[model samples]
Target: MPRRFWGIRRLLRMPVTEAGDQYSIWVGLIYIFNLIVGTGALTLPAAFARAGWGLSTISLVFLAFMSFMNATYVIETMACANAVYKWKRIQSIKRDSVQDHDDHESDEPSRPFNDMEEPLVCGASIPSRYYSLDRRVELGEMANLFLNKTGRTMFYCTLCVYLYGDLSIYSAAVAKSVMDVVCSTIPANMTNVTDWDALPCFNSSSADPEAYTRMGCYRVALVTFAAAIGPFVFFNVQKTKYLQLFTTGMRWLAFTIMISIAIHLLIGSGAQSRPPAFDITGTPTLFGACVYSFMCHHSLPGLISPIRGKSRLGLHIALDYALISVFYLLLAFTGAFAFAHLNDLYTLNFIPTDNDNLFVKIIEYFLTLFPVFTLSTSYPIIAITLRNNLQSLFLDMTRLESYNFFLRKLLFPVVAVAPPLIVTYFLEDIGILIEFTGSYAGTGIQYLIPTFLVLCARRYCTTLLGLGVVNQYKSPFSNIAWAVFVLLWSFICVVLVSVNIIQKKS
Candidate 1:
């Protein structure tokens, strides 16, 4: 029993260390590659088709958006660093006050939630457990802590948004890809000659409808078991090391594969075809998928952090943003041009269904494999968040040390899996889920959080100018301008989420 307990402790307490430089670069590259190859490439053609936009126009617009998101990451990282400093200062002030109290006074600080031992509202008033500076130093010393906890906390929170966004986008593409493959296998004459509504597969009311059953089952299995679990487990076990290796591979692979995909797409092939001008439903789904694809900015901080001295992280972030923008623009243009009118909003379906076309088959296979990888990568992030939340609640409420081990191991996984699974059952379509989740939840976390954090930090900048709170800076106009831009984007996201939900309900 003692040995088993020690083994569990070892598993949970594994420390994450920085990877070597070469591997770290690869990790960043792979992270970007996943964004480009995973689903974005598959979906862009369809999305542009629905938009009725020219290839050039679509390329330009997407590139501009990518650039903006990358820039936002720079601002956010700066804000997070500042927040850590502010939090430390606040802690210092509290400590100083406690130390200066009269000798006769009780050592305990006054509890804000309670007065003279009388409970204000509840059955038992909980006493606050604010830590002293000595305790803070001890905790910091215990871990090989370099980055402040506050910054780490923010980084992890952003990581959750990234993983969830990936899941939502990849799942949608997988569903569409499955449908395309199954439809291709069927005889055209049978589909046409039969009374379409009366056919078992086509009839919406059938016991096991083809579109809803076969494709849907495969999607759910891949998403729940493969994409969610695979990455989650890998990251939990390996963390930064896994990131380093993956990023390094991705950087070179992204440049090579992106060029190849572009060339193949430009020269017409069996898998590629032009899509229709406007399918309201299809266009929205495509847009949703694309938005989620761009949510890769969360990892920008990790990329920048390793570089020593003077805002190098910001420069790296800016460079990555520019590179990603170019990649997306090329993808959107080539894909749109390849499939002129027959564009399916989901890009995975654009690949040729034939088993013989090597490039097409390779891409198709990767599309199939992506869900498993995405889910696996995402699981660790969910576990970490769940563990943190549970720990916070336990410390605040129960204050019991005896059950900490059991709670950390047994409860965390259950909490992590249950909610997403239950939500998955109600959401039949991956496109809708991606659209709704990205526009509402992912957008706020990705765009708004960074902007807000940046604004908070910039408030203290010594160069003062202008009338209102927003306009008081050396770069007053730029600050206010960016703030307004973020606000507008956030508003649009809210509207998109609401409209999607309503459409789904109807």
Candidate 2:
């Protein structure tokens, strides 16, 4: 409010187009927070148990920072895309100046502007209204704008792979959760029921035809899950407002109850098992899981576009990452130390025991079915996304009218749903699925895509708008060296994960 503070205010504030309905920056922050914290968080405690708490903590913090940096890269590219759009609009107006001279007064060279408001071309200031992060340019559009044919194909390939893996993980996790809740009895000792034990879901001495091994029960649940949820793939469905609210509430409430229960256990049992400080055997899986945990770059544009004020957006995002990192540490640490044996699916740890009271049993049952409630809602959305992208890869957009109804609709959805469903039958290990998915496809989305997007955007912006203009939302790691570091890091992660997989197989 003072003259001296005007510079500070200007530096901190960026104004988008005056749309009265736009949400506040705080809403955008919450959207991002929700986006980053998803199914990946469920796998973290198991990753911690394997990797050791010391290594998990250090790796998670570093990965969160890397993820934050790339998220800023995504935002910076969005602004650059908007700037390119503005430049093209100006060019189009300039070409029509003779016929619409009076209406195009804003394009007149006589207008005055500050140095920061004009772009330099050949050392000359080209005056125009400043661009803002108002336009919603999705990642696919950005790929088209900045990348060539090969790069776009690679982008879609990696994206579709990640989505397929996502659906597979969702399928297995939900089925596993259901199997545990339905098949598992309240054992006298809670730690006795291992995930892969050969125990039958029904009594071994029973004469019932429905009796089956635990693994068979899991397969049955997987089939049942597909039968119930797979039809949504055939029909278009969206996550409604209430559905989102329900899932978000369930997620946080479950996490709260889990951490509370874990703390209670620690206090009661005096730490059942002391976890190691570091373990190399778990690092590969931990790397993949952490990469998956911080994944929100692909969806950043949709979340960040509607904020009315984007001033200090980078700082706001940094704050979100800070809070998320701390929350992750808290969750993983509490779970790592509480139980002698942690389940790959953290929710399994809360399965009710024969000794627990009625209220505790109810809570434990709720926790055990948590994945079913949440991932069940998510499965169709992801399947539909993968279907659309798979169609995009195979079908030509220009000839959509020529394609048949079955080709357009039925084929892609079946292609999307069937493979992941089939995979769930063979690969019952959710952790291994997570490790493969997050290590390969997750790395591409989280690290390499953002790295290349920023590089191409910077080069294109310099050529289109010249060097005088700055991307206000540019990443703090805006140097070639950082790009190189990210690339190298991705390569090393792939190598390590691959070696780990090979070792396990041999």
Candidate number with greatest TM-score: 2
TM-score of candidate 1 against the unseen true structure? 0.57
CA displacement after TM-score superposition, residue 274 of candidate 2 (Å): 1.6
**Model 2 clashes, total count:** 0
lDDT string for model 1 (8-43, tens) is 233223222233332344344444444433444445
Worst 10 residues of 2 by lDDT: 111-120
TM-score of each: 0.57, 0.77
Residue 217 C-alpha lDDT in model 2: 86
State in Å the error of residue 338, model 2: 1.7
